[model samples]
Target chain A: MKTVKEGEIRRREILDVARELFVTKGYDHTSVNDILKIVDIAKGTFYYYFASKEEVLEAIILDIVEEGARRAEIIVKDQSIPLLNRIMMAIMAQTPEFEGSEEIKEELHKVENAKLERLYLKAMLKRMTPVLQEPVLECIKEGIAHMEYPTECIETILLLGHMMFDCDTFEWKMEEYPQKIQAFLCHAERMLGTKEGELSGFLQMFGQMP
Target chain B: MKTVKEGEIRRREILDVARELFVTKGYDHTSVNDILKIVDIAKGTFYYYFASKEEVLEAIILDIVEEGARRAEIIVKDQSIPLLNRIMMAIMAQTPEFEGSEEIKEELHKVENAKLERLYLKAMLKRMTPVLQEPVLECIKEGIAHMEYPTECIETILLLGHMMFDCDTFEWKMEEYPQKIQAFLCHAERMLGTKEGELSGFLQMFGQMP
Candidate 1:
């Protein structure tokens, strides 16, 4: 058990170092050698943790998806929060972490690195969707139960919710974040046959994002 | 002038045959030599028209973008059609062509070719957006002139319209074509401050696609 714990800690340490390098230097510019040097790990030890740079990228994306799932799970289980608010919280959970990471912004926006960023984002969304689906569906069920949404078009509404929740992946501007969320919530209310202002509380909460 | 015309025709013939082969075989599987043989062109002739297979792919994407822009121009210029219908027509133009091409489906879905398809689609959208922007702006102007839309939110609404118009690139299902369009149009009407049922006629026409 001690050996297993040590191995896990070592793996996370490598990831932490790699993420720092990737954010500061950009993914393409940061070589495996750079990460190994930063972590001061032997070549074999580095290989033991991650097979290649692409695997490191996949690991980073997996970490993001896991975090999203974890947050979503917490929000869904919190019975005190309204269902719409819970759903909004689950979807909006990613933005704060992203906004907190100021170091990644310049690297992400570098013209030459845009494709790599898009590729990773696309991969992240594909992996994240399946993990978040359950919480999203539960929220939808609660919305239906509360008569806040119609029951007839569950599948379509679920699909639409997935797309709307993935607006970050859809490349919607962060500058227009409030308007986009408001517009999306208004449309979702229309689609689910709810009253116009039924989901306004969630929008009000989203507007307070720092 | 006659020599230029002949050169244009020859270039198009090469593109036509190459497109057929690309649709039938995968892009990676279809070599330049294969295209040359099929078109009965000398190696020098092939090189004269295109530097590489990548260039051919770029040319094909350019063709698609040009066609979209051309259709957008026609729809926007036609004063007889209602402005809402013109906007709907511009968005709908690409779907039928995409749906009708059964051969391209296999190539597009191939795992090895997915990256190439994505790269080309990204390039096509980049080129297509500016071209379509004019017609889209005109539609919004007409909407505002008729007091169907608010003038203050023109920029945001324009951005939203571009997103809505790129639904083909968004990969919304042809299976959910009618529902997607109706839901989209209804939401668009709300966003643009138009009366309910104003855009329903376009949805009726879209449902007749066969």
Candidate 2:
């Protein structure tokens, strides 16, 4: 039998290979056999790590969520940054970029992979809600922001933010995209108790307007 | 050869039967054959009316959306009601209740029917966005609310409101449901530029908090 460390390494290798294939060739196009071909692992070995392709997709999403949580935790704990900037940074950290992320995102937008898209968003919100709550509550306590139901508000904001701003969640027209981002910033400023135009700078982070 | 009127009537009949079966027996359990048996129509007749069960679902959703738009149009045109109340009424009109709506909602919440839930929400937003825009813009013009991107804000609010409040969109625990509604109200007041607690009275419309 393989040692525990060796088994762990094998699982990591399989996940990496699967993610690469999913991004490069698309999730629907990629298969367990393709993963096994790249990882040079037997079908039994692959099944030992993941029960099915869907499970592997879930595993990939979990890894992204954990990485985001870790980054957000660090940002929350840092005191040198301003409260608003730290909060924004922490929020952006939740969308950590990996190689070929854009291609993977394109794949997720297809109709056949919508369930996976939903799964990814749901998983991100579930995992990041708690991690981002710390900085948000701190902002409230510092009088930088005020909310009656801070915890619930945080969760609502995250859910709305994801649903509105995430391209995978909606099929926005090319011109409509920039307007949606702008509107999100405007509402976010109000929701966070920030002054008008305070959050406008973050629009650049969303990319250039058409 | 059937007359145009007869064809339209037969189409409506098929849709009505399909919707009933979908709600009562659950969408997954219902089939085209089941619908045909209830409607007492031949297979060819059913096909002539609806290409597939999924098309019938689209027709049902379209019917609901059109009904909502019609109601909202009337509410928006009613100057007798106060502006705020009219706006609220118009927004509420988008969720027009039909017989067995609660049951249909329950059916949509099932994991197997998530795609239907998403499709329904998307259809509602697409149709209701324009209908609701008139009242929202009126609020901005009357100085009752302020928004930088009024049209975009309305769409974002509707999209967020649906995703956050609609039980089909997320699986909130019993306790979490009320908190989310409360949070939404707080955020809505801020986003709408209403005074704090101004929108609190509308929470009753969401049903009693458990």
Candidate 3:
């Protein structure tokens, strides 16, 4: 039993070191040898933990999903905040941006990783959408009850928000990223039947706008 | 000179047959053998014209780009129509939906072909953007002059329109495709400073809406 626990710990350690290296050197540039060297583990031990570098990358993605779910759970349970705010928080929580390394985020945006990054995003969205859906609908219900949102096409607007803002499909310009976020938020707010500038503070709180 | 002209005709014939097979059978399912069977051409003659099946697909994509550019040129030159209408027409023209087979459109959307399709789209956008940029801007200028559209963020809205509508990134439901198009156009009209329902007739004309 102790050996099994130790093995699990060792596996996690390998993932931690590999993830850091992937963030700094990028997934393609960070070879298995580099991971072995950093973790000071033998080749056989590394192989025992992960079948290949791709497998390790996939494990890292799963770990992110798990972490995002945990964060979302906490935000969703916070009854102190308004339901709509909680929904926005819950959605933002699923994005890897909040606690993730900026360097890793930038590394994933490189041209060589575009295909892999899109795959990761699709997987993450698939995982995150279900976790967010019911909570968001509850929030939408509250918004409608409060006379703050339209009820005609609630589902479509939720999907639009998920695809357009919550996911990383749109490229953000470094200089104009805030402006873009503001514009998107304004549009989303309008679509949801929220008054203009209602969600502006959420954008500021999420660090997406000034 | 007569022989060269005949050879050119033969090359076009090969492409026509290959395109039809690719549309009906998909790029992966349509082997060079199938194209050969359809065209009844010698392997040597086929190889003399094209290097590989991928090369032929690339040629087809180039042909599409050429045709789209031709259509765009006509739409952009027609000053009889309103500027915003021309811009909308120019965008709708670039999409393969206007002329290509629905089977080919569906084939390009398959999971196995997602990467290849994205590459094709990126290539198409890169090639087509430059050709359409001047005319689009001129239309924007006309829109602004006519007070039908906003002036401050013309380029951004154009980019948004191209990315949101021209690309096949968003999946449309069979039943709700028309409704989604209407919502998108309404949002875009609002963003562009046009009055609501201003572009409804254009969507109806495109057969995207009843």
List the pairs of residues colliding in candidate 2: none
Off by over 4 Å in 2: A1-8, A77-80, A96-98, A168-170, A208-210, B1-6, B78-80, B96-98, B101-103, B168-170
Q: What lDDT does candidate 1 reach at residue A148? A: 25
Per-residue lDDT over B1-210 for candidate 3, one digit per residue giving the tens place of the 0 to 100 score: 459889999999999998888877777798888888878988888999999987787677677767876787688778897777776787677666525565565555555455545555555555556655665467456564222223213333444444345443343456766665666666556545555677888767557521
Judging by TM-score, tell me the better candidate of 1 and 2: 2
Ranking by lDDT: 2, 3, 1
In angstroms, the error of model 3 at B27 is 9.7
Instruction: Give the alpha carbon lDDT tens digit for every residue of A67-144 in model 2.
Output: 877888799788998878777777776665655665566755555555666777777778877877777888888888
Question: Model 1 clash pairs?
Answer: none
TM-score of each: 0.58, 0.88, 0.58
Residue B195, candidate 1: alpha-carbon lDDT? 66
- Please give the C-alpha DockQ score of model 1: 0.13
Best by DockQ: 2
- Residue-level lDDT of model 2, residues B20-127, one tens digit each, is 887788776888999989989899988877788877876887787788778988998999987767766677777646567655666555554556667777877787
DockQ of 3: 0.14
Best by lDDT: 2
Window of ten residues with lowest summed lDDT in model 1 chain B: B145-154
